[model samples]
Target chain A: MTDPLLSVRNLRVTFATRQGEFQAVRGVGFDLGRERLGVVGESGSGKSMTGRAILGLVRPPGRVTADRMELEGQSILNLSERKMRRIRGSRISMVMQDPKFSLNPVMTIGDQIIEAYRLHAGGAKGQARQKALDMLAAVQIREPERVMAAYPHEMSGGMGQRIMIAMMLAPDPEILIADEPTSALDVSVRTEVLNILDRLVRDRGMGLIFISHDLNLVAQFCDRVLIMYAGRIVETLSARTLHEARHPYTQGLLNSLPRLDAPVDRLPVLPRQDSWRDGGPVGESLETDLPGGL
Target chain B: MLSLALTLLGLLLVTFIIGRVMPIDPVLKVVGDRASQAQYEAAYQAMGLDKPLVVQFFGYIGDVLTGNFGRSISTGQLVIDDIRHVFPATLELATLGTLIGVSIGVPLGVIAAARRGGIIDQVARVVALVGYSMPIFWLGLMGLLVFYGILGWVGGPGRQGIIFDGMVPSVTGLILVDSLIAGDWAAFRDAFSHIILPASLLGYFSLAYISRMTRSFMLEQLGAEYITTARVKGLSEGAVIWRHAFRNISIPLVTVIALSFGSLLEGSVLTEIIFSWPGLGQYITKSLLAGDMSAVLGGTIVVGVCFIALNLLSDLLYRVLDPRSK
Candidate 1:
């Protein structure tokens, strides 16, 4: 099989707090090959940290260490800032959780999209404008011209997220790390945004790292799922078999969800166990059997 | 425009009331304390001080609007004419000082914030601290001692050298510009040399505030999520900081700059005194010392109007900088 688009092994992120070193992401690993890979975890469970580590967006005082982190077989771990910048928006881009905070408010949407594209795909502004319009249209934004001239505050939450997606995808990155891109939108708008993202990723054949806490949404949207607990992946399974997850933590999480088909008086609470804190690395052994696995 | 008019009216009223309530009698100041009671009464009636306070306020506002600010007892000239002569010098000094402050302070602040906790940041902090806390009069004296007295790098006190003094015709009332207009480069250099030290002292004073504000505003912008997005877009760190973050802070920074300029325009009294510069500050200071109510009240009103105008300018800039405001 051809090599995966991106690969990682034994990724760890540590933050030095007043209470000593806190490992936010510990020994996490995965591979992506033009497919939707969902990372599901509770808040503070390292899902977002993993995405930031890949982008080298972690500020100082927070540390990221990994045995191997590669994109197309090239070591991307610990690259100098200059070298990493060329790869970032060109090869791997990120769509943050909320477009409200992610988009520069003072800048016009057109300028922002054009800036993102021109930074990586050096071209005159006229060419960048055409590219930006095309991107806005690709994200199904009506009246790309008006949207381009508009500011972030002028757009709705859904529209803002779509613009963010357009900006991130304008350079045609090999991978798009979407950190809860739809979580900020209304539920009705969430499906619409996800559909746009799904269609774009499929059409572009770009690997997607969909970081979210919505178990049911991830089960339906992603090709495979990684269930993280305490910064470590406790379960890795096909999205189709998410309900039949093997790990007790995954099973408990699934059980805790409220279901309409089989209604219960009360959803069972997810009981914790000490052993799950240092669970064996299930990610490595199960990496090859998934639907899109190499 | 209506608000501006109303604000000016209010300022005139306040100044008029303060002048009346203060125990320093304008009539006594004009006719002298030893003048006979009949002479004092005649001067008071002539000056319209015998009218009710409300009538007097409206009278004062009317006079201000019509460009009649009464006659300066000290200068023996119309207060309006005196302000016209003295104000331009202050305008020139403050404008130069503000220019110096903005150019150095903004870049320094940006660098300090961008490098936060680095050597540049530490140095910026120290500079800002010194600028903020050090007394301007003392700074001016030290500047004079080092640059003028000891080193002889700059011309000593006053607006120009003794040789060039009053050489250039008063076309704009700004010595530098007036000298240039008259094609007198020697006078211009001397004027600049004399103005430079005082202006630099004021510049250092404003720079402390501007840099400190810029650093804080930059620090806030740097931590914003959009800044992170810019970095993720593969822009260089410089682009991320200056283009995106600095651009965002510039709106509020305009207000900082405007307020600092306004303060410098009116608040350079000490600098003017130390340098013996014949700017509005010194004019107002001398008027107040000699109990010249007309000149002092007129200067106060002018300073107040300047503050309001600067605020209006900053508001206009806010709309230009941030479209959301518009």
Candidate 2:
């Protein structure tokens, strides 16, 4: 087996608020090889925090600590901000939720792409521009030149998302952390974006941490899945075998997803248990507790 | 463009009407009370003020279009010529003032925003508050007392010292430029020293407003998601600020700077009065008190034109700064 591109262990993120130190992520860890790892969780589940912490992009008042975090076996936890900046986009870039806000409104698409390229790709302006254009085309943009000069507002959600993907991938980062890259996109374009992402990762042999709340999409798209609840990874399963997950949270998540084959009367709400927050193995007991027969 | 033209026309008509309705007789003010009634009649006739109000307004509009602002009753010079001469002085002062404001204020604001709630931000906020609160006249006086009377660090008020009188030729009507054009560094230094205190005082006012605006603008830009995108691209914090973030703040700062410059042109009246500097604020005030209608209207029109031009320039600048604009 190939070595993991990135490995994280016992990572925790705590925010110091006016009231007290509130821990958001606790002892969450994963190893990302050159494969798609989908982190599926609902809002406030620390999925986005995991991605941001990996990139070292978390702002002040939020603290991140880990026993071990390595990119290709090089220790990343102790690196200074200046040193970490060298690795951020050139090696591990991020795609945020909203492309409309992620893209600089005043700047042209060409300028933004060229800026990203030149930051790490350092060459002549012409070379950087050529690389940008090539990357834009690589992302399946039909009219590269026209889109290059167009501003962010001029593009649609799909086109803007494509442009964002092109920009993030331009630096040829080893790992791409896409935090809900398609949640803002409509259903029609979501699959298109997924296909593009799949193709790019396959062709480049890059690691991807696909953070999303869409369980069905993750099961359909990714190679492996990590189910998170209350800042803990409750279950890790092969996407092919996600339906066979053992954890109650995972089972609950799966049972909650409305399947077209069953045609249920109503969608089941995820029952909350105070003990579930501990994320211990209580799968079989809760499995029988579910109203629908498994 | 049509609306702009109408606004200018309306401004001129209103000022003209105000001048006509004032209790003082413009002709008597020009000819003097001792002059014969015939002399007063001739002076009014010469100005074509004997015509109907609408005709007189149209006539004034024609003269204004031709760059003739009529004769100044007090200064006895063409109103256009007075503005042309005196404006550059104020321009030189305000330009330098605004330059100081932007150069220092913008960087200070950026730093304060980046280090928000830190000692530097606290210091900047306190300084801005003090600067904004202090009256320009008191600041000007205090500056004069320390820099001029006490330390002898700079020359006393006016465009230049008596030594530079008739020495530097007026090429651009700006002493600094004309002195440089004449290759006279001594005259330039002398001119510079005389303007230093008043310009600094005016600059303090601009700096306060600009720094406060810049701080808010930087805070807004820094919080934006694009800043995160820039960071994710491995761009340095400085690059993220100066390149990505600064550009965002710059668009709004341009409007602020332009408006401040426009207000400065209306005469830093307090700065002018305290420093005994001869500019439009002092000119208009003296003319208004003496009820010199031509000087008053002409000065008002010149100031109005300047304000409109600046506003238009700022609007045009928006298109250049923001590509989202059509």
Candidate 3:
């Protein structure tokens, strides 16, 4: 890629707990072009924290630092809150994990989408409403006008997630960071949501940071995958070669999943190794190709 | 609607049972201990005490439904008339107090939540603690001493100053409003001055509760994932706090505010006594002391109805404010 949409090097997120300083994301680095870049890790492995840190959403006592965190060649890390807010929805936006808790229960779907669009776009109410309806239709919601007047509780989980996608993409952001967007959905609905997201990203030629713990799903959906282990990127490989990963942690994760073709009596538990925490990092240095850098 | 009617009926039944079962006798209260057997018998029959309890209850319910609450032995006026005259005084005071409380409390709470663990939060906590724990009568008395007794900054005692009493026509039974209608600026000033101190004291008490609730509600909402979404949507912090979080809390906050208002209306007995304000609290207390069961039961019933009405109002508001309820 001529110049990646987002570039980060040595990003770290720290939280001050009663026991001591705890590092959530340590020395994590990546580059995002107009492609689906997947960050795969188990719970507490810092994939979610990385997404929040990039959006400047981390609350107090949780500090984020990066040697170089830029969005399209501009340093975005640690910008003033007012300035950071400008870049948030318009330049780069985030979709939370679950739509059930992600949409305001009181607001109408139209009002929420309109509000989100107006916050960044700042146009007339009619224009915002028009834009909201268009966005809803873009996400393939039937009866956009009727759905707009309905509340979050009235919609199913799949519809709610689609509404969320519509709202997040309404501002036309350069990059969309979706944090486990389809985890709360059913298997059938999950594929539909991913398809909508995939189509939008490709249509807009926007960079996407897809965060998930489903390794196989990431391999099938993402162009590139960053395997995280204990707050650091242990491996970076093209999604096609994810199963053939050399890292012991990645291999352990893959082995833990029960495969249908190879019917096993008992699925193997991942026996974690101590070296995964602070071992020599497996990926190449910052200066490398955007994808398939390994 | 049926539940509402049933709830009120149950409330009236409980009050009626309590009145009848109490040691004080209604016939004795009217005929007195020295009355002859004939007078006592006549009074008992007139009071419907001689009839079956079931019959008496139905009679009382009929009387209440038709707006006849009987006559007050203490005030020598009809029970309905007495309530009509005095309830508004308490209504005016409580409304003003609640207005003061909600206006100040909500913003204080939002600020405290936004700056949690900061100086403003600490101040709000202390204020709520003091207002919640402090005795209202003592607060009223102190208010009288500093503002009325010492500084003479406000009118002392009663709903209006002696000079302005009965000067304005009883249009709405609210002196402040009546004075305004009469174009009696002097009376309005006197009524306003007299009401301010007591209203402020009640307002302070309510503010404590409102602010505490608002803060907790805001904190919970602030932590919600939707709030994160709002922030990520590039909304100004003010918009996120006031428009999104505050709007969500308004549902529960309505209940808090309505309950506080209702309590202030019926439960301002201490403030009324300290200030010698001839409101419902004072009216009920005076009648209760004189063993005037007619007046006492009537006042109690009115307060209960008002409480129920306030609850109904809040429920209606819940439907208006929360989409899920609808």
Candidate 4:
């Protein structure tokens, strides 16, 4: 079989602190083809760090080391910052969680997107602007001209995210990392953003890494799911098999999420365990103690 | 815009009224206390200080409109001519001071923010601290001793005295201007040598403020989400910083620079005393001590105008840098 679009192996990230070094991500491995891969974990579980590390955004004092990190058979770990920059938007892009702070406040949306396109394309200004308008329309923004002239703060959250999505997709990268992209939007706007992203991924045949803590959303949207806990992946399963997860942590997360079909009087809670290190077999007592079977 | 205009007009009116109401008896003060009452009354009438306060204010305003500021009691010269001779020197000094301050401060701030917590960043922080702690007067004295007295690499004792034997008065009150007018390369070199120590001493205080403000502004911008977004776009570190981060941080940095420019224009009295540069700082200090009312009032009005003009310029810059403001 051909190699996946992106592959990571033994990825380790450590941060130097006054209290000594602490590993944020320990021996994590994953691969992405032209498919939606969901990474679900609680806050501080190194999920976001994994995304930032892959993009080479980790700063000094926080070190990222891996035995193997490649994109389409190109060794990403050894690339110089300048070369990596060339690959960033053109080959890989990211959608930040919040549109409010993600967009540059001082610049008009059109100007910013046009600049983003020009940075990679080396095209003339007018051509870049036309391309930006086209991308805006692709993101389902009606009256792209009117929205282009508006500053980021002038647009609503949903509109701003659409503009952000438009900018990110302008370069047509092969891999798109969406870091909780819809988390900050209202419920109604959240589905719209997800749909836009889904359409872009499907049409472009790009690899999508959806980072979030919501299990239900990930199950519905992603093709494959990785359940992370305490900075390590505990289980990997097909999205269709999420309800039949073998790991207790994954099952616990599933149980914690409320379902619309069967409203419970009181939702079942996960049994507390003291030494629950990830990437280990589920304990017998914890498995047998589950309130319900898959 | 209307409010700004009205505010400026009100400030001018208040200055005029306050200028007339102060009861120092300018004639007696300038002519000394031993003068008889008749002599004092005659001197007051001659100087037009004997008129009622409101009348004097209107007369002053009318005279100003007619391109006159009356006469100086100490020198018996036209007030405008004296100001013309002195103000240029002050402006040149202030401009040099601000330029030096910004050139040094901004880069230092950028480096500090970029290498935050590193050795270079630590040193910058320490240097800014020292600059802030050292008083302008003490710093001026120290600068003169080190750069002029001991090093002997610069001029000493007199204004523009380091390289040139004596003053070469030219069309411009500023030495650099005069040298350029004279087309004398040697004089230009001499003037620059003399200006270096004094201008740097004056700039140190402003540099401290600008560096601190720039550092904080840069820190805030570095934390901004767009910076992260820019990084993800694959822009190089330098482009991410100078292009994206620098432009955003300029809003606060511009305000700090403008305010510092206003302070520089008011003059660094200690630096003026140390170098004996005939700028407004020295002029105002001498006039105030000698009770030269017209000169002191002229200096005050100039400083006040500097503040108002600087504020207006900063507001305009705010609009330009942030389109959202409009």
Q: Select the stronger candidate by DockQ from 3 and 4.
A: 3
Interface RMSD of 3: 0.6
TM-score, per-candidate, Cα-based = 0.97, 0.91, 0.97, 0.87
> Which parts of model 4 are misplaced by more than 4 Å?
A123-127, A145-150, A265-272, A279-294, B2-23, B26-71, B150-152, B157-172, B178-186
| Pairs of colliding residues, candidate 2 | none
For the second chain, the TM-scores of the candidates in order are 0.96, 0.93, 0.97, 0.88
lDDT, model 1: 0.91
Candidate 3: lDDT over CA atoms? 0.91
RMSD over all Cα atoms, model 1:
1.9
Specify the CAPRI tier of model 2: medium
lDDT of 4 by residue, A28-113 (tens): 77778899999999998889999989988887788999988999988898477888898888898999999999998877888889
Instruction: Looking at model 1 chain A, report the run of 10 residues with the lowest lDDT sum.
Output: A281-290
Leading candidate by TM-score: 3
Give the better candidate number (1 or 3) by TM-score. Answer: 3
Residues B1-326, model 2: lDDT tens digits: 88789889899888878878889877777787999988989999987788998898888788888988778877889888888877888888888888888788888899999889989899989989999898777778888888899999999988889878979888888898999999999999999999878887778788889889999999999999999999999888998888889988888998999999898988877788888788888888988876677787888888899889998998899989987777
Residues B1-326 of candidate 4: C-alpha lDDT, one tens digit per residue: 77666765676677676666677666666668999988888888887776787687778767765647656666667767777777777788788888989999998898788778988789888888998898877777777788887898887644565447445766767778888887888888877887777777767777887888888888899999999988887777787788888988888788899988888888777777777777788877887776677777777776776788888999999999987788
For candidate 3, the per-residue lDDT at A124 reads 100
Candidate 3 ranges beyond 4 A from true positions = A283-285, A290-294
* lDDT, candidate 4, at A49: 92
Candidate closer to the true structure by lDDT (higher is better), 2 or 4: 2
Greater-lDDT candidate between 1 and 2:
1
Across residues A136-181, which tens digit of lDDT does each residue of candidate 1 receive? 9999999999999999999999999999999999999999999988
TM-score of chain A of each: 0.96, 0.94, 0.96, 0.93
Model 4 alpha-carbon miss at residue B294, Å: 3.3
